[model samples]
Target: MTTPTPVVFIHGLWLHATSWEPWIDLFQKEGYDASAPGWPGDPDTVEEARANPESIADHGIDAVVDHYASIIKDLPVAPILIGHSFGGMIAQKLLGQNLAAAAVAIDAAQIKGVLPLPLSALRATLPVFKNPANKHRAVSLTAEQFRYAFGNALSAEESDALYERWTIPAPGKPLFEAAAANFNPHSPAKVDTANELRGPLLLMTGGKDHTVPEAVTRATLKQYRHSEAVTDILDFPDRGHSLTIDGRWREVADTALDWLRRQEL
Candidate 1:
C-alpha cells in the first residue's frame, strides 16, 4: 500500500525550522504531510535561540547530516525534501543516499565535490571563517552583515524585521567542514551524485543572491550532470539569499510545488 507523501523541510543557519511554517501550510493544504525539524540542540523558539546561541555549537557536517537522516528514517514514508542554504546541502546528501522521494535544493551550500567557490559564497562565510576559533563556537551576524549576505534586495525596515524574527547564531563547525570539504578526502560533506538510486533532484538559485548565488547552484548542476536520475536547475531573478524568508517566498514555493506535481510526487 502507498502511504501519503511526507514533505520534510530543513532550515539553514540563522533561522529556526519553524521559519518553514508558511511553506508547511502551503504544502499541507496540497495534501502533503510537511514537517520542519531543526538541527541538534536547536532552541525551541527564535528568542530562545538568540539567547542560547552556543547551545547548537560544535556540531559538524556529519553530525547535522546524521541528525536529519535519522529523522527521515523514522518517517512513515520516503519524503519529498525541500531545503535552503545549508539545509539544501542536507537534502542533496539524503537524495544521494536514496533517502528521499525527490529533493529541492535552494541556493545550496557547496558540498565536497561541488567545485567553484564564488566570491559571494566566501564572503558570506567570513563571519565564521574570519576567526579560526569559531569552528568550536557559534557565530552571529550583525545587521550589516545580514543585509549584505541575505537581505540586499530588501529595504532596511524589511531587513530589520526579518533579522529580528528569523536570525540566530549558527554553529561554525559545519561551515568549517564545508570550506575544507574539497581538500579533505575524508570530508563528510560529500554527496553521491552518480547514484542511480537517487531520485529526481532540483537546484534552485537566486540571481541576485550574494550567498550561494546562481553560479554556485549551476556548478552543482554540472556535478550532477552524470546522474541518470532527473536533475534540473531553475533561476529566480531579482531574488537574493533571503528568498526563502522574504515576502516573495510564495512564488518560490509555488514553483517548487509545480515541479513536484509534474513529477507526480
Candidate 2:
C-alpha cells in the first residue's frame, strides 16, 4: 500500500489557519493528506487568536519559515505547499531550501529582490506601517481595510462576511522585515531564487490584488530567471488577494490541482 501525498495549506496575515478548511477537505477527498497549520504563536482557533493578540505578536519572517520547516522535517515526505500572502513567501523559502516537493505561492508577499511596490500595496499595508511600534505588535484590520486588501473583487457584503468568518490579528514583524529586505543584506525575506535544484514552483497572482499587485508578482517571476527548475506563474485577471478564500476559491484550488497534476507531484 502506498501512502497518499501530503498537502500543506499556509494562510497569510489576517486570516486564520482554519480559513483553509474547505481546501483541506477538498484535497483530502481527492486522496491527499492535507492540513493547514497555523503560524508560530498562533492559537488553536480564531477566537483565541483574536482574544490574545499579544500571543501572536513579534514573530518575524525567519520565525515563520522556521516554524514551517520544523513541521516539514517531521513529515514522512516533504509536502506540497500551497500558501497565500506571507504564507506564500514562506512556501517559496521552504521550496528553495529543497524542503518541499512543490510549492504554489498565491498572491505571495514581496521577497528581498522584488522591487516594484505599487501605491495600492502601500495603502493596503499602511495600517501596520503607520506606527513603528506595530513591528512588535499584532494588528487587526477593519472591515473596510479587509475589503480593500483581500476582497476588492468581491461585493462589500461578501467581503465583510469573510472578514467576520476568518480574520484574525496578524503579527506585524513580517511586514517590517519584508519592507526593509532590500536594504538588509541578511534579510529574512531572502529566498533562494537561484537554486537550480529546488522543487517546482508556481506563483499565482491576482490581477486586482491591492496588497501584492501584479507588478510585484511579475518582478518576483523575473527573480527566478536564472533557475533551470520549473518556475511558472498564473494570473487571475479578475481576482483579488481573496481569490484563495472567497466564494470562487474552488476555481483557484482547481487551477492549483491541475498544475500539480501537470507537474506529476
Candidate 3:
C-alpha cells in the first residue's frame, strides 16, 4: 500500500491550534495524515491557552518557523503545509527552504518583500501597535475587534460565535517583526522565495480580508518571480480573513485539497 501523505496545519495569531480540527478530519477522511500543532509555548487547548496567556507571549517569527521544523523532522515524510494568516507566512518560509512537499498559504501575512500596507490591514492590527509593550506580551482581541479583523465578511452573530469558540491571546512579536521586515536586514519575516527547486506553492487571498489584504498577497506572489518554481495565487473575492474557520470553511479546504491532488502529492 502507498504511504499516505502527511499534512500540517498552522494557525495564525489569536487562534488556538484546534481551530484546524475540521480541516484535519476532512483531510484524514480524504486519506491524508493530517495534524494541527500549536506554536511554541501553546497549550493543548483553548481554555488553557486563554488562562495562561503569558505562556504564549514573547515568541517571534523565527521561533515559530523552528517549532514547525522540529515537528516536520519527526514526520515520515516532509508533508504538505497548509497555513492560514501568520501560519501561511510560516508555510511559505518552510516551502521556500524546501522543507515540505508543497504548501498552501491562505491569507498569509506580509513577507519581507511585500510592500503594500492597506489601511484596513493597519486598522486590524492597531491593537498590537497601539502599545509598544504589547511586543513582549500576549494580546487578546475584543469581539468587535475580532469582527473587524477576521469576520468583516461574516454576520455579527456568526462572527461572535467563532470568537467565543476559537479565539485566544496571541503573541505580538511576529507582527512587530513583519512590520519592520523591510527595515531589518535580518528580519525573521524573510522567506527564500528565490528557491527554484523548492516545492510548489499556492497562495490564497480573500478580497474582503481586512487583516492580510488581497494586495499584500498579490505582492507576496511577485516575490517568487525570481524563482522558476511553481507559485500560484487564487482569489476568493467574497471571503474574509476568517475564510479558513468560518461556516464556509469547507469551500476553502476543498479548494486546497484539489490543488494538492493536482500536484500529485
Task: List lDDT for all candidates, in order.
Answer: 0.89, 0.96, 0.96
Per lDDT, what order, best first? Answer: 3, 2, 1
Tens-digit lDDT track of model 1 for 1-265:
6566999999887788888999999999998999999999898888898889889899887888899989998998889999999999999999999999999999999888877888988897799899999999989999889998999988988888898889888999988888889889988888998887788998999999998878778888888777789998999989999999899999999999999988889
Candidate 2 local lDDT, 1-265, one digit each (tens): 8788989999999999999999999999889999999999999998999999999999999999999999999899989999999999999999999999999999999999999999999999999999999999999999999999999999999999999999999999999999999999999999999999998999999999999999999999999999999999999999999999899999999999999999997
Model 3, residue 24: C-alpha shift (Å): 0.5
In candidate 2, which residue ranges exceed 4 Å CA deviation? none
Candidate 1 residue-wise lDDT at 92: 92
Candidate 1 — which residues are off by over 4 angstroms?
A: none
Give the Å error, residue 48, model 1. Answer: 0.8
Which has the higher lDDT value, candidate number 1 or candidate number 3?
3
Which parts of model 3 are misplaced by more than 4 Å?
none
Q: Candidate 2, overall lDDT?
A: 0.96
Model 1, position 3: C-alpha lDDT score: 66
Q: TM-score of every model? A: 0.97, 0.99, 0.99
